[model samples]
Target: MTMSSVEDSTQAPFVAPEIVTVGELLRRDLHIPDYQRPYKWTVRNVAQLIDDVDTFRTYGQYRLGTLILHRDARGNLNIVDGQQRFTTFCLIALYLAKHTSADVPDTSAAALPDVGLEISKANVQDNYTYVSESFGSRRGDLSHWAEFFLDSCEVVVLTVNHIDEAFQMFDSQNTRGRALYPTDLLKAFHIREMSLEHASPQLRLAMVRLWEEIPPESIHQLFSDYLYKIKRWANGQDVPQQGFSSEHVELFKGIKEADPSNEKNRWARPFLYAKNYTDDYTQENSTLIRYGALSGVEYPFQIDHPVLNGETFFLMVRHYYDLGLRCGLFQDDAGAIFDVLPELKPVLDLLDAHRRMPTHQLVRNLFDCLVLYYVDRFGEQSLDRAALMMARYAMAPRVQSKQVRRAMVNNYALGRSSARPPSTNLFQELRLATRPQEILRRVLASPELNGYPELHCLFTTEEGARR
Candidate 1:
């Protein structure tokens, strides 16, 4: 198909454009068409693209064709629509550039720091850009296949003006297969500029305190899902709405109190508890717990974010620590489990001997312990027993296969999970006592019991879990 101009009304004929590798674009010119939505790919996509390319020699569908870029003198290229693919290619290129280079300084070119990508200003592209723009970077793992693709794939670019025209051409020229979502496009816009810093450490750190506890491995899905939902909401689409109803203003309010200086008791206040209230940070405060729970799904950036206020996001941090506790890495003395199961006392002494062991070491230990506990308590059907196990754990089922738990745990212990906490109130004490029976009792006994709110309201009522 031909490249059209937003500036002109002419629908031109298709013309083959000059082919270029991502390296050339980095060295010279690239601009996203006004019509080109935004970069949306996450690290997962980046990793996957690399893997796909890596399989090219064997897997027939691996090699992606030349990407068309409409460049402008301002160094801005009207992506006209291959933005996601283009962005992904650039990230892969960066990965290849970094991993293959012997010089450590050159490796900085592939630097994919953990931060949000905001593509708003000129000269926005920078070192971190490639990583945030591509799914490969978001996914955080570059397989051998991806490495191969990063090392080899080249992009073909076409230049023109009229952002809409380019975008329309991009939309129509799809001979490949599936069409990407507009949400994906919007995401690409930011993804493309991943190298630039989007938020300050304050904001980023606040975000971390809010949702940092989410497993690093699942961050991509959480981010993608939230961003997609928000975009759909913005477009008046019928995307499923979870609960946050508050507009952006209210959400920010929650974060404002999240600061350490603000005194209003907040979900994040607990996090400061961790820092030992150092003189500089002790003044911080966050209202996440009070407002977050009250706001429900109407939460700002209601998506599964990494942090909120200054506290570790509830679900993620709680889950991670819970997992650790389950594995005997943490323990409770008086039946009260501290968040991380403090490494002190009798438990610490016992674990000290095995501290150097791998993640699988802990996971298997936990698994064996849990199984034995269950078997002793209620035999093999313990999972089905009336004992509210899910509530006790404050997490969902092991939906994410634990096959890699060993490796994942090792990464976590090594501080490599890029882990963070969950949003404020996401795992408040409410989650800790989530057993259906407990909920039923709470509902029947207390006005505020609400008993799991919507999802299990029926379970607490005459209706059961199915209801």
Candidate 2:
């Protein structure tokens, strides 16, 4: 829970870190910055904290963890890190003050902090409910335990004036509890990147709200299952067996739009033009008569296109998240596909109804990634034909082999196979293709489908239509 610090001799006098009890720390005005990740501690996390406090009540002093604070010009202490632990402590204080006979300070007598994000608010409500029930069930006089909790539980507080220094410390500190996810690290990185543009606080808050609205698990899956695989496979690289991790984050961190060199670079022209046009059109035409038709014009985003760093990165995630929903990757009902592309229904329905063995599921993932990539590149142009092509390409391995592994899937993606000459790598083809026919023209070798009559019929009908 503790971190090592070095003192600077040339700079202004260093503010010494202080060790304060939970009660003492709660007396200060604490704030959670909008750019911080949503509170994600679960019920088990709360219960564990309570148990730890009870276990060490008689040990004189129990250090909770380190809290990094960035003190703003107005003297408000913004939580740069450890907001999760700090928030849990606040909940405990509130529960004890209302339900127990603990001599809690008057400063701690307050309502729960209003959390703006839905995910954080939900966790706070759940954790509070657990705290109330757990505290109420405790036996005998509980005032002493409460007193020990408030007075004995300690945390090392490190206060800094600059946000960058606070985050640097956060990155270096040894986290004692839940580990930060790769998504969390990405959020922090993009938020810092946005800061360089001096983005307005309201705009920053809006961006965070947009991010927090989506379920965290969905975002993780979107990156790990679809985006990561598509990026690697399109480049003719083997996808890691372990899927996406922190090492792969750099793939998403492309050129910063604000960088002078990149802004002037020829490669950034299309992205910059799209962003500017979208912004200008929305601003000018939003209240006009044609608003309905033109107001929601978005930055043209492609899955293979270079990711613009900062705000656009958030937009890119949202863009694909909505796409995933429409494609029925996150939902159970296939109705969404009917709404957007009725042509994909038969293939998607057949896949959904089939037995989902591990290998089968891998093929399913491959199909989903291809459909997503095709749509991303060409929109609805020849979408039905593109979908059939993707299905044939993705499902070939599943039908040809009874036991398909990760390597087999990867090889099939790269057009490497032993049974026949290598087929066209559809992903690579899509990356190079400007027109749908360029991809649709590539012929697929039909797989031996002895047991899968439905698939055989699907391929036969598609081939017949082509002829």
Off by over 4 Å in 2: 1-18, 37-40, 58-61, 106-122, 139-141, 168-178, 289-293, 332-340, 419-421, 450-454, 460-467
Model 1 lDDT per residue over 1-467, tens place:
11222233352433457655444445554444332323546555655665566467465333366555554324354445565676555544555555444111122342221332243111125423545454344344444434434334456666544434343455445523535433233222222222122334344333333333333323333223332333333233333323222121122122333244646655555444443443233233334435553322212222222234323233333443344343233333443433432322333333334334453244333232332223222323423322233221211111122243533433332223432321112112122433434323422111222222322331243422322
Give the worst 10-residue stretch by lDDT in candidate 1: 390-399
In model 1, the runs with Cα more than 4 Å from the true position are 1-14, 33-38, 57-62, 65-68, 71-76, 102-151, 156-164, 174-176, 182-467
Quote the positional error of residue 284 for candidate 1 in Å: 42
Per-residue alpha-carbon lDDT of model 2 for 316-423, expressed as tens digits? Answer: 899999987766577533323324367677677777776356767888899999988988888878777777777877777777777888888887887776745356
By TM-score, who's the top model here? 2
Which of the numbered candidates is closest to the native, going by highest lDDT? 2
Every candidate's lDDT: 0.36, 0.76
Which 10 consecutive positions of candidate 2 have the poorest summed lDDT?
1-10
Model 2 gets an lDDT of: 0.76
